[model samples]
Target: MKKDLRFLVVDDFSTMRRIVKNLLHDLGYANVQEADDGKTALPLLQAEPFDVLITDWNMPGMPGLDLLKAVRSDPKLAKMPVLMLTAEAKRDQIVEAAKAGVNGYVIKPFTAQVLAEKLEKILAPAA
Candidate 1:
């Protein structure tokens, strides 16, 4: 993955967001923005250009799956890469996200290596 890729990390918990930010930084991806929930994230997505979206599956206003659906539905944002970084690990939920068009999915408690591999897998197609 390119280090310059702009990333939007959306999660309800500040700590989780921070952790993800730190991990991204460690991986040399510095151009990262954040939102606490999908509701907060949607406007940013519409307003700015992001190379990828990293979102949680559960949140107060609009969960990740719903946000993923919204992104897919929007004409401008339809092709944006989305990685579901969440704890929603049920097989059905994973299938749902895949059907909704998520580029990648990582369960919570993930390692940096795993995240890196997933990013590479998704970005490679476009690279």
Candidate 2:
């Protein structure tokens, strides 16, 4: 993963956002931003350029899935990499995210190593 790449961490809980931000910082990604929910996140996404998006699934309004769909549908943001870091671990939910074009998915309570691995996988060039 590019150390300088901009990241957007979206979650409803402030503590969760801070935890994710801290993890990313530990992983050597310093340029990070936070959004409380997808409704708030959408505009930032549209207004700015973010290399990666790490979002939770259960937000009050717009949720992560809807945000992913919106990003996929928008021509400008269509190619953006989205990594779902959510507590929702249902098989169907994972399948739906994959079908919707998520670059990666990590269930909550993930370790820093898991996050690093997922980032590497998503950012890796196609073989």
Candidate 3:
């Protein structure tokens, strides 16, 4: 995975976003943008090119699942990688995310190592 890839980290709580952003930074991904919710994230995604999206499942507005669906539905953004970094841990919700086209999923209260591994797995070129 490239260190310079652009990343968007979306979460309703500013603290979570900050934590994720800091983790990404520590992982050498400095080009990270933040949005408070999917409603805010979708517009930024539509406006610019983001290499990866790390989103929380619950939010005040459009949730991460809807954002993932919208991204998958958009011709321009369909292929962009999405990682659901959330607290939602139900098996059904994980399955739903897979069905909706999320490239990766990481439960909340995650470690920097876990985040790095998921990102690397998703961004790795297939052999």
Candidate number achieving the greatest TM-score relative to the actual structure: 1
Q: How accurate is candidate 3 locally (lDDT)?
A: 0.92
The candidate with the higher lDDT, 2 or 3, is 3
- From the highest lDDT down, the ranking of the candidates is 1, 3, 2
Q: List the residue pairs that clash in candidate 1.
A: none
Q: Rank order by TM-score, top first?
A: 1, 3, 2
Query: On residues 1-127, what C-alpha lDDT tens digit does candidate 1 reach at each position?
Result: 5689899999999999999999999989999999999999999999998999999999998999999999999999999999999999799999999999999999999999999899888899766
* Candidate 2 accuracy as lDDT: 0.92
- Evaluation by lDDT, superior candidate among 1 and 3: 1
The runs of at least 3 residues in candidate 2 whose Cα sits more than 4 Å from the true structure, single-residue gaps closed, are: none
- Per-residue alpha-carbon lDDT of model 3 for 1-127, expressed as tens digits? 5788999999999999999999889988899999999999999999998988999998888999999999999999999889999999999999999999999999988888899899889888631
Q: List the lowest-lDDT window of 10 residues for candidate 3.
A: 118-127
Give the clash count for model 2: 0
Cα-based lDDT at residue 28, candidate 1: 91
Model 2 C-alpha lDDT per residue in residues 1-127, reported as the tens digit of each score: 4588899999999999999899889988899999989999999999998988999999998899999999999999998889999999899999999999999999989998999899888877621
Global lDDT scores for all candidate models? 0.94, 0.92, 0.92
